[model samples]
Target: MASKIAEAELDSVEKVFAAQEAVPSWKDQLTFRSFVIGFLLTILITFIKVKVSLNTEIIPSLNVCAGLLGYFCLKVWTQCSSQLPFTRQENSVIQTCVVAGSGIAFSGN
Candidate 1:
């Protein structure tokens, strides 16, 4: 059974490795704007989650809220500044960060 599982893993790895392309550097994605936006969203989302949970039994989906809000805010930010173009990848990272940070904050309460 172990051998069979190893063979399956090896097959999957080989298939994925063959299709892989040169990954873009994450350093470029780690911008000051991303951190600032992520941190602010984290605080905002955490507060919303805590308040909602306190008033009602329903907890809002963090990912959905974060993604929507992050994209909208980033779009507005882009319009205000012509220097940086907001990419889907950056938005995703910010959303993930906000969700994670918010979860931690909410749980801490």
Candidate 2:
């Protein structure tokens, strides 16, 4: 049943969170690099959203687009620099910032 599936998902989420807390990464999640990347991505995504809105009136989903782009960009950056740590927390922060920035741009119109 759907209820059983939902309960299983909830249980899995709980276990994941518990495990995360048990093994702390202890890495800096809010680094300057994350902010810089997030700022650039926000500007880029905002511009694209504005242009798309003007042309097709169909705004793209910032969460999916920004998350994927941010992840890819960070991965590439890490591979190149080899100094920056690619932590999930940092990626989530950057993605959230970019998405929020794009949302603000959309609402301002």
Return the number of clashes found in candidate 2: 0
What is candidate 2's CA lDDT for residue 28?
Answer: 66
Q: Write the per-residue lDDT of candidate 2 for residues 23-66, one digit (tens) a residue.
A: 34545677777888899999999999899889998987868888
lDDT of 1 by residue, 1-109 (tens): 9999999999998897676454546986677787789999999999999999999978787798899988988889989998678766788889989989998888788
Task: Score candidate 1 by TM-score against the native.
Answer: 0.74
Which runs of model 2 end up more than 4 angstroms from their true locations?
1-27
TM-score of each prediction: 0.74, 0.72
Once superposed on the true structure, which residue ranges of model 1 sit more than 4 Å away at CA? 1-23
lDDT of each: 0.85, 0.84
